[model samples]
Target: MTLTSQLTVGVAAFDRYLAICHPHKYALVITRSTSNIMCILPWILPTYVILGPMLGWRNWYPGIPCSFDIIFPKSLRATAYIIVYIVSIITAILYLPVLKTAWRYYQRMNKYQQNQTRDHMQTTNKMKKAILGAKVTGIVTIAFSIFWLPYMTLSSWIMVSPTAKSKLESDLANWLVFFGASNSIVNPIIYAWKRPDVNQQFKKVFCGSKPVSHVEHIKT
Candidate 1:
């Protein structure tokens, strides 16, 4: 779940990169086929490469029930952390051009809009949309780290330590797992709310109202 949720943020970051850094090529590069593959790989790789092998471990401690939700053994936990770190690093790298472009747009847009022409108005609006999308991506990244990092740290600690901790500590770890799982639900809401163009669609879907603007929906 953590990997899949983070990949959505990377998807958005990549789209923002195309839009901001290479606007002319976005439509050509992000075609129907490519987009489908981008969406599919995340769900497939994590479940198969990470979760699949973990489930197939042969050296389970005797007498432990063979259930899916067990506390991961040391090797499995380390593997999971490695996958998480790789995903996080790649996502962070994708954000670089996005943030830099947004900063550049902001600097240019601030010069003078008092005597704006139609072309200037259009450019400014596009820049604003880009900036908003970048901000939403930043928020998603921060939220993912907040919810998942501590849970992973504590889980690794539990695996390493020889003795069992107190009931309170165990309960805290369980709650952290729930918190990390909630990122999947929270992420869509973040994308919808933060982007002005998307917020209109959000309202229309849940509120049963007319769409507010003809603004193109920001890709997530």
Candidate 2:
């Protein structure tokens, strides 16, 4: 589930990159059917990876109770880690150009805002919102990396040195696994913090009162 969330985030960043960097091409290429496929791909891909061993495609360690522990053979586990890290790296790389383009657009908009008409101002505001959306995704990506890296690194170490596993090490790995899973909880909070509509809705639900003032909506 965590991996699926991460993959979905990558898909979102790709969508924003297309919309902001290559608007004309994006308009031509991204249709309703294409959007639905993109939404489903993340879930399907991760499910297949997670279920491969259970489905008898890969060997699992016998006599080990199913948990977060390394249950797969060393080679298969290593291959899975390699693929995950490579995809994560590529996703991070893709965000770089998207953020750069957003920042450049922001600066350009700010420079011209003083002389712009109402319609242009609206366009400028839309660009500012897009930039904010990009920043939110960047922050989420950073959070995901921070939360998951310790477990990934420790797991890689264990894979390299099977004999190094001990009670203390096992406890630490379990803690890190829980910590990584907490990223899913943090994700919604991050979105709520950055998005005014979500924030207002949260307030209404939890506080049972209208907000004192309307917060400008920041689309994410």
Candidate 3:
């Protein structure tokens, strides 16, 4: 799940990067097959590299039950470390470019506005979409990092701790897990909120009628 979340958000960030930094090439670079493959890697790595070995070695370890919960202590510790660091690194790599791209685009747009550049309306519209994509990417990146970092940190600590976790610690861990899980639920809401067209279509489907005219369309 950690890998999947990071991968998905990373792709979203890359999409923003292409839209901002290489607008003309964005459509060509992010084709349907490319996106599908990016989506598939998270599932593939977890299944083959993580779970596959666990399944194969399930019988080798006798005392620890052959279940997902019954991981070897060392393996759990390593997994904990992997999740924490890998996610953080991948997120940084993904978002840093996005931040740079957004900043550069913003500066260009400001300069254009001040200079009264040609094709003002068209340029502004494109800038708005690029900026909007950057904002959405930023939201997803922040949400995932904030939600998962604490949980992963606490989980790693727990995995390495010699003593058992107290009731408070256990409760806190459980709550953090829920907080991490909530990001999945929150992401779709964020996307729909950012894109008015999506929200309007969603409303129409449920209402079985056209959306109200007063609903403000997102400029992007």
Best by lDDT: 2
lDDT of 1 by residue, 1-220 (tens): 7767777667777877787888889889999998998888778856764655467644458898663335445566677677777778877887787778777766765677577899978876776676666778889988999989989888778767788666786888879989999887888888667766566766788997777663455332
Q: lDDT for each of the candidates? A: 0.74, 0.75, 0.72
Between candidates 1 and 2, the one scoring higher on lDDT is 2
The TM-score, computed over Cα atoms with residue i paired to residue i, of candidate 2 is 0.80
Runs in model 3 lying further than 4 Å from the true structure: 46-77, 80-84, 114-120, 164-168, 208-216
Query: What TM-score would each prediction reach against the true structure?
Result: 0.76, 0.80, 0.73
| Model 2: residue 76 alpha-carbon error in angstroms | 3.9
Model 2 misplacement above 4 A: 52-70, 162-164, 200-215
* lDDT for position 124 in model 1: 66
Give lDDT: candidate 1, residue 91.
75
Tell me the tens digit of each residue's lDDT in model 2 across 71-131.
4567766766786687688778888888788778868766875789888766666666666
Q: Name the Cα RMSD for model 3.
A: 4.3
Candidate 1 stretches with Cα past 4 Å from truth are 49-76, 159-170, 214-220
Give the alpha carbon lDDT tens digit for every residue of 1-220 in model 3.
6767876676677777787777889889989998898778667655654774557643456565453334444675476458647666766776676678777766876676666546776666776777777787788888888888898888778767899777787788879989999989989988887877677778899977687532245353
Candidate with more favorable, higher TM-score: 2 or 3:
2
